[model samples]
Target: MKKEASAKTWNTLRNITLVIILFIFIRYLFDEDPFNDRIGWSVLILFWTFKGLFDAVEDKRSGNKKSMVANIVFVIAGLGILLWQGIQFFLYK
Candidate 1:
């Protein structure tokens, strides 16, 4: 139980940090005014992260495999978005 809690905490923190970094890079490094765009992207990230976590927890409660593959796919998608945004910032700057 404790181990599972720790893993959950870690995943949440990691997702949050990635979101923050993506926001920062877009705001400062890119120097592009993505005010509304930033908000939308942030919301999307938050939604996906929370949804994945909830699904995982529900699966666990039901004695399933916790949807590990789906969770990982979402995480990877989030990271890929950040990377693409970062590269666009660099390339355009």
Candidate 2:
């Protein structure tokens, strides 16, 4: 019972942290500054890349093929976006 409760508490904390980070990332993405845009988007992409990869492994271990594949795709897309971000700066900036 204690272990279950502790796990729940940790899950709650983790979820809260995710939400806060997401909020900050969104703000950064929407800001007027070009650097802010890059930083914001990078934060989200890095988060998605790392979290998706980690979750993919965890899902695979738990035999959740559907979720595992989804995570893998997410990681791929995040990497793609990061690559694009590296190549060019928009004229608007």
Best by TM-score: 2
lDDT string, candidate 1, 1-93, tens digits: 998998789768767865775665455534456554654565556556655656666567556764766775776787677667768767976
| Candidate 1 positional error at 73, Å | 1.2
Can you list the residue pairs that collide in candidate 2?
Answer: none
How many residue-pair clashes does candidate 1 contain?
A: 0
State TM-scores per candidate. 0.42, 0.57
lDDT of each candidate versus the true structure: 0.65, 0.80
Candidate 2, residues 55-90, lDDT tens digits: the string is: 787688679999999999999999998877766655
